[model samples]
Target: MRIELEYNARSIPPADVARSFVPPTPHFGRLLSRNHTLLLGPRGSGKTTLLKMLTARALNSWTHPEAAALTPQVTFNAAFVAADIAWGKQIEAVGSFDFNASRKDAAFVLHTLRAIVHAMREATELAREGRLTPHAKHLAIEITESQEEKLVALVAPNLSVRPALPSLLGLELALEARLDTINSGEDVAPFTVESFPSKISLLISAFNGVTGDSDRRWALLFDELEIAPTRVKTFLLSGIRSFDERIIVKLALAPYMDDAGFERNPISPHPLHDYHTIQLSYPNKDDARNFGEELFARTFERIGVDAPSLDLLFQPPEGGSQLGRRGNQKRQGVPEEFVSLAQKDTSFAQYVTERNLLSPDYRFNENNIAQDIRKVLPIVVARNYYLRRFDGTHAVANRSRKSHGLYAGYPSIVEITEGNPRAILTCVGPMAQDYRQDIERADGFVQVSRSIQTKAIRRVELLLTSLLQVVPLDLGGFDAGKGLLGFVDTIGRAFEDRLLSRPFTTDYVSTFLIDENVSDAVVKAVGMALNAGAIIHVPYPDGGPDTLLRGLRGQRFRLSYALAARYRLLLTLGDRISLSTLLLVMRGVDVGDDQRALF
Candidate 1:
């Protein structure tokens, strides 16, 4: 059986969201509460999927240990207010009218009301079809003809076109036509658009009037608020407390500021005060690996196949002793690269001999080589392997035949993608698709060879680094997006020089700290990098505040692990350097009077 995985959750139909759903990390429970919540992470961080899974249609279709335990306690009626890219762009392009802000806001609020009405209709249909749980049956709401007319009159009294029929669907169409007139940029008289509070409070009052269930709870799950127009997005972010206590607002956005970078936009809500924040990406190595492995196992279980763990599925390169059986092989004294480099480079030989890895006679110290050297084998292997090919001038060495082995193994892959669900799946999805016949033949018993995993790692590397060209950014006078790739190359070369330095140092560069007083263009570039996941924030220890792109003055960040293989850097967070110093030292000599400097 060729198991197909749909990585994009938004593309999945609302009714089928549960069918494609993989149980989220433990953060799902926090969102089930009445408090407003924000799901923060870069794109492909499973934000949309988590929000969609909250709706009555998805909840009714979903069956899992976690869902079973949590759903019975869910009294609220959840509605998905999907603001996708196209719709968001349309909102941003609305014409300037007499009350431009008010009209644009009204358009957004009216669309939100339509989604809520649709949700209520869905719940009623589920109840009629006997698909809702006994407890969830009370969530069904029916809007009478009179109630629909009353809502249309209250919320959209100034629309040129009134509902042809007195029904919820007719009201939705009328609002749609009104929005179309606004977007058409025609001459229209100014109309009264209700404030968010007035509209929402009136809608809730109407709901209570119809259902007679005054104690009912409501959750508005807003997906992709990051792409929404600034006025609309900021209003939603800043006004979480203004809504009624019975209604909860859930928003999904990236960690960086809006497109208006570094202008002190009042968008970031206070965590635990305004809303409970749920992070979708794991930065800790151990946490990421555990989550990635379980996700792989559980995902395969859905197809009636017992998938092997990530460790069992990806065999490490033959050079390292870390993967157990490969270490105990009869032919191993140390990796072959060690012996080869010891003969050619006196520095590596002396360094290994001092550590008891090589003998006084310049041969293998077999007794000391097996267990004592296992701890440093990855660094040893990476440094020795790249040192041979690194020509002193360039930072990135030309790829040799065995260069891919440095990034192959389970540890490398998990760290490369930082256990992001979409990234992890991207690495393995290709291999699974390629080996579908083999998997079916063996009833899903399969192991991805090091070569195949290496290909996946390199593919991710190319895709990540290429983001500098693919993502267009406007940074006033700088064109920072174009300079970003060269900037990355300079950083990579600095780390490589450290790794291949004389006498072999383990303290190679891995992370970087941003200087507080850099040019605003540089700050904007770094912010864009963070938003693109090209650089990930390393948090402070012991519950210290991680202000990330907000307070970036002294924040530490590392290049995405996808570039680790490209530059021969290890998967571990090795050491930190000033990003400014690295750039100045690497390319400072090339600065001229006329040309613009990258730093």
Candidate 2:
């Protein structure tokens, strides 16, 4: 029962990953549409995997029954010329081409054209190799030949030696040779930027010919465009706008790329008017949970686990007796078993009483008692919850309090990972391995041990810490400075104070209410933090007004649980904090100070 799963999608080939891929429904629907799309998400949010899934190779390799069933309905019915390019690397490759610094913009356009041609060529090869359906193969050949003819006609005037039409190989060779000649300090006819749009139009026309007039059903799946040179990005965006109806240009971009100054490029058009955007990551609680369930189920099945559901893996032991009756109905309180277990330890008993676990009026008992226990026990038992143990004693503190320890459950783990496929796999893979080991060493339905919970929490904390560390570096371009980190810390402290004080807060906080009078600079910093996944935005109900706080009435923001746990803001998911109080705590603060304390 020792199961091993690949947590890193990059480590596996696209075909292989596609074999086990679980399609994210809404996101997948958007991806399959024939509209120009800009997919925005943080790193590890399955952008690469989604790109792979859209390719001809992945579609052809669909052996899984469920995924295969959907192929004919979407992927099989289309003439998709998918190209998985690491645009960052493409930018680097441009340096090798002979182009003056002043002509960088023109050079970028040429390089992009070359890339599009390369993608078409690669697609044709896949068809030639019989990876695509017979009809798709026929279309691929026609598309390839037509593209070569158009390309040669467009650039033939500048070429030292004109290549024949219908020979893509000759065109590629000639193009490369000419570039090499230019790189070696030889003079060549410069390509004009004015002709760029015409060349792109021809390429789009070739794609259109292959797909036919069937509702303009052709797609170019472009992955990792976030790292492309700014000029290259602008050129691509312009192409997208021009070919809006004829082709679907699907691009996977980092969140910050949206604000990467598209306006600065003369060729770029307004994104709001041109592209349909789909966020690859989950934006709310329900979406996260649904995704997590499917992901966990698939991974478990792959690893040979026979569990019915993900809940089984995290369920508490089952011997808790029902408490007294209330009005002929059960007066829900802590399970008698849990009460008995707590009684064995004086500090735990006090902790239970302080949290009102024995009271019928307690909210925890009204819900699933076992689930409530599972959530609270880990936080209470965390090593940091007590005073420092100089003598290495196991004694617990009399009162329940906030701890400088990472404590979380499966839900929080999913949230912290931010629906990143690799992060989720890696985070849960070890836990599954450990669980299998424990089962082998025990009897039927073994209880998840305290040590396992502790280890899992620590692992999640480490993962989140690694993710958070990248935010500042990534957002450095925004010049938000240390205030960005302070903003994050402010949210974390809010969670922490809630955990320590009475009457816990549960729902998301309003951004406007957090600090109504805060400067626009701080608000922008907060937005950067959101883009970085340091904070999450939970939109106001009905996309309408949020009237919770008086000063700021219609804005929304939610502290990310993963970040809160990483910073020891709160130990468990059940606790809530007051946003108004948190606002006061963060107000008038000089976040730029090097010595600014988080608490």
Candidate 3:
């Protein structure tokens, strides 16, 4: 049966995205917790969808079994407040809202308070509609009325013209109009900074009053903080520190906001300390696999496909081949496969063995030869040839001539997907579409060809590359964009030199260590790449036991199979690269527009 997939979530409205959302495994529990939280992840990692789900759950409309199960764990009456900061238009419209050197903070805080009040009003309306419990309905109304009364009292005495109603919305409109009049040189008292703290205190008190007890809580969910004006975001974050325990603030932030552009100051509250962080992206391989499976299953079900197993969908096409038994033996340290493959070319095995004898570090002992065999055998068996020299050129390497079946199996598809949701969506949609088109053209049931898989994978690579390009990589002092390009180039060269091995049946390209002293910008950029499914981070084997004890850590960044294939950086199995070489290359290489462009 033919199936269609929908992969791009950004084009969908928030409500629709929430309706089809699947909670990522790692952070579902924390997302339901009452503690203040920062949901950090790259675009398309489902941060906005999660926020919408939370908003739906708060209103009791999200009836999915998973969301229902988590409802009992929540301790708060929650409301979602979107920070739609239209800085340019707002600055032009609000004449009296001066962002002067001395009064910027006041303007920011005022704008933020307006958004919160608006959200509180929305929550009150929800309660009136019976979405909330009877007790909550009464409390919401009471708080809304009281907060409106206090706000009116604060702004009424200074107004040249009185508002018709003592409501918060009326006061805001009147204040804007009054500010405009004052900016035209009319003699009226301006909204002062000293009065903002008191007004904000009253609003907070109203929010706290809704709970009526310290044990009860109210959550203010803030979304799109990454898009908020700098002054506005600074004010909001600083104000969060003073919130009482009864009020929880859950913020949705873009990945590496601080590293990308937000300035970090010692005086501001640290995200790690002030709030719990729920990462939306997969942290490891297992998580990626599980998430990928869940997403694949969901998509299949939506398209009326009975995909009971991800393995079935990803199964290799008939006639596709894997490494031979001898290659498997080489993986386990037996050099028979390597010797046999090389022997096909008249004593090449003996020639290499004899050549190794001349070098002090290249002994021809069984252990050393077996290691070499492990590294070289897969390349030979896959390409069906042996390289005579370690030349740094992919053009000369014995790569597969049959491009169609190279990426033809379910296991191989999973490797290409790298457990990334967007990658899965972008890939599966086109593959399914192609499969359907093929069936229609043949006028009967038809199998998806290897060419289709290759095309879909290429499309995913281009999509990822495009996504990565938009992630701002300049972190003030560190040139992360350049560093990342250099790093990828270094891996490409390593693959050409036979220093890193490529996986035939999996998505991992090769792993190389990152130095401890790598700048945080580069580290975060790597993380962004991982979130984009451009790469994956593999911790050192044995968890680098001593690094854990010593509190020293290093990351092994593995190129995503799709990206490696796109760049022609895929290597043979068992090849390896050193950290020193990578660092040297990264420092020396220059990134040009040609290198950055996906096309």
Which numbered prediction scores highest in lDDT against the true structure? 1
- lDDT by residue (268-370, candidate 1, tens digit) is 4565666777766555566566666766666546445456666776667765533222444555456666676566556666666776665555344465555
Candidate 3: misplaced stretches above 4 Å?
Answer: 1-14, 57-59, 79-111, 130-201, 207-216, 222-242, 254-274, 315-397, 400-405, 438-448, 468-556, 560-562, 568-580, 583-599
Q: Write the per-residue lDDT of candidate 3 for residues 110-136, one digit (tens) a residue.
A: 454555555555555665566564322
lDDT of each: 0.64, 0.51, 0.52
Off by over 4 Å in 2: 1-13, 73-111, 131-166, 169-195, 206-217, 229-240, 257-274, 304-307, 315-416, 439-450, 470-487, 501-528, 541-555, 567-599
* Model 1 pairs whose backbones collide: none
How much is 445 displaced in model 1, in angstroms? 5.6
Indicate whether candidate 2 or candidate 3 has the larger TM-score: 2
- Estimate the TM-score for candidate 1: 0.81
Could you tell me every candidate's TM-score relative to the true structure? Answer: 0.81, 0.67, 0.66
Q: How many residue pairs clash in each candidate?
A: 0, 2, 8
In terms of lDDT, model 1 sits at 0.64
Could you give the candidate ranking by lDDT, starting with the highest?
Answer: 1, 3, 2
TM accuracy, model 2? 0.67
